[model samples]
Target: MTPHELYADLTRSGLNLIGQALSIFDADLRLAVANRQYQAMFDLPAELTHPGTRFEDTIRFLVMRGEYGPQDDPEAAVAFRVEQARTFQPHYFERERANGCCIAVEGAPLAQGGWITVYTDITDIKRQESLLRARSEELSGQVLDHAERLAAANRELAATNAALQEAQRILTRTEARTRQVTEMVPAHIAHVDGEYRYTFSNRRLPSIFPGAAGNVIGMTVEQALGAPTFDAIRPWLECALSGEAQVFEITHPTSGRRIRIALTPDSASHGVYILSTDVSAEVQAREALSHASKRSLAAQLTSGMAHDFGNLLTIILGLQGRLAALDLPGHAAQDVQATLAAARRGATLLDRLARISGPREMALQPVDLARLLRDVATLARPSLAEGTVLDLAIDLPDGQVLLDAGALQDSLLNLILNANAAIAGPGVIALEARFSGEWIELTVTDTGPGFTPEALARAAEPFFTTKKGQGSGLGLSMVYDQTKLVGGTMRLDNTPRGGRVRLRLPLRPIARQMILLVEDDDSVRMQVRGQLTDLGHAVLEAGSLAEACAMTDLPGLTMMLSDIQLGDGLGVDLDASLPMVLMTSLPPGDPLRARAQGPVLTKPFTQARLAAALAEAGKRT
Candidate 1:
């Protein structure tokens, strides 16, 4: 063909063969020729299209990098395309559209001039390529990991094979030795399948059960024992199959012999090994020990219950005395009062029994030892004989001691009554408390006959009492328990005047603050006011919040003491200047209780406690 004709033919063929868009540039990177596909692919603006348009200018107009940005490396892309054209190798470039479809450009140099580039819509191919690449990367990582693991497994297998060979040699010798030893031992030695089928048994099996060893191997528990012993061993056999190792003592009724059996399952070997030991002597000893423990526990429970009952009786009798004094003219009043009193007394007795037999689980709270002592003395005063006078002289530091209030009260009441009973003349039962270093020391002094050496030594032993006919002797034991529960120590010593039980409870230094006492009950208010006043504080009394709020003039009030439900109603206005402490008998978690701002001291608290809580609040403030 002629040169001009060849050029024309080549241009036509190149434009057609390029597939979509064809573009060529000179070494200087100027636009030479662009096919119809090229114009359409770029959405070439008619305004910038002319014969001599610069390639770089065209790219700036045609290309947007990702979503809405200019191409970052346009110059470098041009340079790379130029290099590919000069090198005579086909060059490929991927371009993406706004719709996420990708166009692949396969650019090649035209033999006549410039470059020929084909545009292929390769969005699907690109997506498949991405998935394939991700899968390949994952598979490659897995293959590398698998190869390393396989290598490690080979090494482990080799080592295991060596160990197995050595173990096999040792096992052969052990089996021979085991068979010899088995025949010599008095007890039968045997192996069974996971299904409990007998795999092996020693000669002793025949002696234990005549002809039992014969045909026992490869036979089930039922087959070997003929359904009798199998019934006894069935549960254990099932447990073994479930992969549990069982060791138990069974009594053979027919043999009348106690035997200890151990069965261990081996799933890999599909068998369970059985070991039987004669334990008739051990069984008898254990039975005897169990019986003795039960007797001891029963005695302990009885004494504890009796002592608790005594405390409850004292409370009931006190209430009953007060009830009897009241004028009740009608039959209904008398009968109802009598019935109620009887029921209360019965409940008290039952409570005592429950406390003695039940576990001594106490919910511990921070308590003042001095306050607890005084309250106990006052409660027991009503129960004391006419001549007995209870004196509580407590001088403890304002410190918190962990304790259970009910149990402590019971212990104190028991001691006080015991003191009243002991004294023939005018009796003085003094509950004295004081802080000594890290402990609060409590001494119960009685003007009675002092404890003997034996009595002092056995004071805390349950059921060991001097008042044999009258006492259960668990009073001091309960006291001992209380002392231990609070991580404290107790001592029974002869006082200069009479008998004294000294208890020292561990002290935990807590924040001290002033307290506000709010109560409408006159006796309760007086008792609490006196208690707080004696604790050395500026005691502010408020029967209601109006009275509580009236204390705004008291410049140094640290806490506002208020009742949860006052004589009028609940106190809604909280004096923010002072922390509020509620003194109420209402159960905790009551909605009214939530309205209070400070810690609550349940009603019927002693003066020392009111003082200590106020002091704690004062310190925190």
Candidate 2:
């Protein structure tokens, strides 16, 4: 038999037995043939369908739903199916119905001219394929999701690493700052191990010893320092090893100098931190001060005794004056008057001696620095050598200070006289005063050859002098001692042009004498008020010149004591006869100096002198 005849017979027999559906069609839309399986499945009565039936119509009849396309484009699916079959040579397709009918359609080319299309009712197989496709899509989505999660985890890890690096950088910067602070510290610092090995030391440690330049780490203290100092430090080292800290002083052998040393325990290595400081200069200064203090005490004792003796002489002189007034025998009375005169001269000598010693009992009172400055200028004029002239430029505040009047006046005279003697030719002697907080400061500047270094060093030392024949060497020393007694400080130095002495003494904040004190600096006004109260004077307080001026019209206001640099303006309009004293913290050359009508006083005057000046003013008024 022929191959085509055999295939046709086998196809027919297989379709009948397996209830399979089969179809054959040309490229044109026509029903070529249908197998028995196809007829049995759709319940067709005829083996062959009507001629000229479109392929799309047959496909729509087989498929209840429009799975392919609209009825208007029925030929569109036919063209697509043909093209698919041609491209793949053969293809398998399945269609499913909503009511559970599943069909697999397979098209393959026949050896004859046309092709055969077979439709098999594989409902279960097609259903399984669809379920498997959905599961595969779900698995693919899970893979994509997992990939995104992994990418996000990678980004988080990178950010964490970056943050860690940033933290490490901050820690490094903090450590660097800490190291710089440690190195720049002024004190000596060092660390040593149990075996006396030097662990660490700051930059200043080497400067203190001058011997440690090379690396000091790992060298025992004894090996590095060689002997006694190392032995002396052994106990301190042992204390640190025993977990205890120690602080002590010892003399170093190399420099043979006393040093203060401290040891602290280091927990990391059980070592010790050694800190040593040089106190040699401080020790010497303390000893010198102690000696000078002793001398001053002795001088004070002598002065006290001499002062008592002077009081007794005063009584004797007073009695003699009365005795001389009495009319008596001429010879006897003359002899008694001579004895009294001699006793009075002796009393004057005692007073001079007491001045030489540092006088103990002093009547400290608020003194007008301006008046004292004027008096010193007057006293120094007569002492100026042949061609020399003394000049005084003063800005004295009516402000009073608490001080020993006689001693301060004497000190001022000495300074002025010294200045006059220093200059060989005519020279200007400038005296200036100003308020400094609670103290009044006076500067006496002289245009003359400056003091030599030797003289400057020994200026306040007793019995030390540059003047060969004329100086007793006790003038400045007495000044210094007196200043100390009054709780003041005096500095002698060479100015740009000549020699100068600056004296600072605490002043009473307020003056109670029939005057009003006005100042912008509240502390200064308060201090001046306190000084006035101390001197038994009543001081009216105002914060500014305007306030004081306003009080001028007010009842019971006596005198205006206002600062030149007042809140409103300079106190230049103060009543001239009302005893207006311009108070200032500025020096003499200050413009306010010329504007003030009454006497000006710098800040920081002693109590007694201020009261005397005020008393004199009151008497004049």
Candidate 3:
């Protein structure tokens, strides 16, 4: 037999041997289970004793038979009993039957919406009590009455005790379930006493603060959170304890995760309930969006001015070039050449402004850091003087990191030039690369006079320079701007030997793979194909997304470049197996282009720009 059947059989046998009649009724007042003694004691028929028999039917039979003594109305007596059962109160009572017998009845409600009743015959005990009262002359009438009342009170106490035990069992189960739910939640939930000690914890301290101890039930707030984080939230904790709830975000020390914590006061107990959740990704996305917004405003302000400035510079450059080519005096020709040079420089400045201030997105791609460091060193060596020594240290691991290669290269070249200028052609310049935390650290150190305090403070500001005649004052600023644009950081300091500038960008792995080029226009397709080939990628051609989908199974085609408004079909519907970079001549404000994630290359992009765009598009998957 099943275990449940065995248990039921055992329960029935145990109840039968107890010498007391027992019955259980469900929430609907229908009999659920009954012992053999129960049917025997009540002299009930099979129909009334069986499970699912209505309690009212049983009561009506006994009432009509005068089992509860002669009643003015049988219906009234049965109705009263049925209504009392509906309330399901735990009770104990004794009743004298018509057959000169007495029985004790006790009933208690079940936790799961039911009631159980027990009946015990007490006819012999009642008879002995009556006989004792009659035979003993010393027993007063008042003492006899108190003795009977005491017995009734004892039975009531027994019934109350049974009810109390059941309630306790239910409460224990509820508390266990509640604790399990709290422990499973991703966020931390805790309570701190007035003395700042943890009174309750869900054991999620390690998740909120990566290096924190998990078993911190009784630890002081400072001890659990460590000194740095504790101090940061101490004032807020105090405010919460003062009955004002508080919520704030903080960055974890070791993991660099952003945690948003809410502190609610337990007004009655004078403690604080804490809820904390990680919000690192949210904060990063928000900062990136804010940076993009600022760039948009900058672009708006500069586009018109830069456009007019460009026309003027073009006119001056054209006039100077024509004059220089004509037959003229030596001094006049020299003047013409000088004017042309200045006009060209102005045009260069305008282009730089557009890059630094305009909405130029970071074209990120997987770049091999070790190789990038070597290339930087090679490009920088020609700028160094004969007396100066250049040192290149490649300490990076064998992996690729995502970054805007062109922008980063330009920043490093600026650093090299700045370092060369600082050392005055006769000192050592160290170019170092390595990994630190989640960033790839690149440090350029030169043997030269360090920056003055004023220069250091304003070095990253636009148009701030100490070199009066030669410098445009935008190099360091441009480097700082580029770093921020890519969600990276830049710092400048002085070592004992020289000035040091360090850039730390996010580390992302890059893998070289073949790219499929999809364009309907032959010229545009050819041009893009050549650009991909220039970037050392094996390229495949496709005129439509249908062709692209057919090529999805090609082993080497790991990435795709497609035009959104294609001749055969929309590029967005192409098989998503390959990471995609979409090309469009649409304006930046166009919803279709603006909503595009990852990388997008506009019309008329250079080979270097196409390389960067492809790298970014490769990350979409």
Candidate 4:
């Protein structure tokens, strides 16, 4: 037999072995399960004893057989019993059958609906009580009667107690299952009373906000979420308590994550329900889309103007060239040459404007920081005046970071050239690059007269240059545009040393390691294996945590890429010494996913995303 069939047979055999008769009906009042004793006790036919038999049919059969001592209206009696069974509650009772046999019945409701009933034959016990009452001469008649009644009452109480215990078991299991489901959700689900004290929580606060208390129950909102976060949402909490629902977003001060909170008034009580989720990724995507839309609009508006202006510049350049070629006076020739230079500069400015307004995609690739910095220094050194010193310093982890190399190079070169121009004579220009948390910070500082108050304020604005007629005014603006395109930020500041331009970009390093790929699904394992191979990494595959653990002794194993939920064990329980990157299909708020020690990649990720995850894992090592 199959395992399921064997299990069912075993269960039936065990139930049949019980001394008491047992029957269970589902919420629909249809028979779900019954023991052999139950059928034998009622002398039920095959049809009434089988699963899915209606409760009304069983009650009608018993009533027609005079089981309830000859009811005047059998149909009405069956209807009454069936209706009682439909609205079943925990109960206990005893009744004498037509055969003069006494049986005690106990029934308890199930948490998921329906009820289980147990029947115990009490004929012998009843007879013993009657015999003691009638034959005992030492005890008075009234005393004997009272003792018999007390015995019967005690038996009834015992049955009721059994039903109550069964109900408690069901309730406990139901409560446990409810908690498990709530804890699996990726956000914080909580309820707070009118006084702003937390009454319930799913223990997901820590996952939604870094360093938040895991259990907020019995704590005030300000105490659990800290003063700053509570103050930020205090007004909304007040509104919710006053029966007004609220939904809003806030930036978390500690983690810098965007949090979306929804507060709803609890109609059943004087409280408010709260749901908090981390929406940083969503906010980032929305901002990127908004920026793209604005750039597209700018391109559309500037295309015609740029074309017309290009034609005018061309005409001016052609006429000026012809005038310079003629036998004109020296002063007139110089003026013609000047006109040609002005037309060419205008053409250059138009090209820069087109670049700024046009659509452009970032070309991200792994770039060696040390080498890139050296190249930038080399390019900028030639443009420096005599005796000017260009200093370069780089302090970063030992890995190639993913970035748009051309864009970064152009930005840095422009900053260096601007610094060079700012210094009147021999001076020092310092370019420094370092790792700052999850960003690469590059600063270009020059020992020159600091920017004027007005220049510092509008330096990054397009066509807002301080270089009179010698500059096009688009250098810093182009740098700012490129920085934003890559989700980076640029700041223009004046330090005690000189003028400083600092750029901060998200750091994504490229990690190529001897990886152990552990996944339970064969197809998924193969697909991920292919991705890893395409990224130029040698991969070893395992179908489960056990298999993966067995291969830990393999040589040259630099890191492990594993699924969070494996067959034998969790990926988080794998070798702690080895660098690991976990993959999962679980929601971000799930406790298992949130508690993972290493970086996690959600399912259906591309090869590029895998590479980035591997890099993050490599850094942890």
Q: Residue 133 in candidate 4 has what lDDT?
A: 71
- Models 1 onward score TM values of 0.30, 0.35, 0.59, 0.67
lDDT of 3 at 456: 76
Give one digit per residue, the lDDT tens place, for model 3 in 1-621: 999999989988887787889999999999998999999998989999888999999999999888999899899999999999999898888889888889999998987887999999999989988898999789889998899888778878888898899889989998898889999999999999898899999998887787788888889988998999898888999999999999999877555578999999999999999999998768767755654565566567778799798999999988888888899999998899889888999999888778867556767655776787679888888878878888898787776666788899999989998889888869998999877766678889998997778877778766678887788778987888788777676778898987999887766555666888889999999888876765567888988778877987897678888898888887767777668888899877777776555577788777656765665665566
Put down candidate 2 lDDT per residue, 1-621, tens digits, no spaces. Answer: 999999978976875676667776665645666667766766543523554556555555543345443455656665665455444245454556455687666665543335566666767654564575566765676675576456445544554454456557767888788768877875677788777788886656555554644456677777765677778878778987788888887655454345778888987887889887876556545644863675676577666687577778888888888888899799979987897978877776565445655336456765666787778778778878776666666655556555677888888887877787787678888777777554568778888998899987678876676778666566777777677666566677897899988887655454455677778898888877776777776677778666776777666666666777777777776556576666666788787788766666766654454554454445444
Provide the lDDT at 583 for model 4: 96
Candidate 3 or 2, higher lDDT: 3
**TM-score for candidate 2:** 0.35
Candidate 3 RMSD to the correct structure? 9.6
- By lDDT, the best candidate is 4
Go through the candidates in order and give the C-alpha RMSD of each one to the true structure: 27.1, 31.9, 9.6, 9.7
Worst 10 residues of 3 by lDDT: 287-296
Q: What is the lDDT of candidate 3?
A: 0.83
lDDT for predicted candidate 4 compared with the true structure: 0.86
Model 4 worst lDDT run, 10 consecutive residues: 287-296
Clashing residue pairs in all predictions, respectively, total 18, 41, 1, 1
Order the candidate numbers by TM-score, best to worst: 4, 3, 2, 1
Scored against the true structure, residue 341 in model 3 reaches a CA lDDT of 86
**lDDT sort, best first:** 4, 3, 2, 1
**lDDT of each candidate versus the true structure:** 0.66, 0.68, 0.83, 0.86
Q: For candidate 3, give the lDDT of residue 544.
A: 79
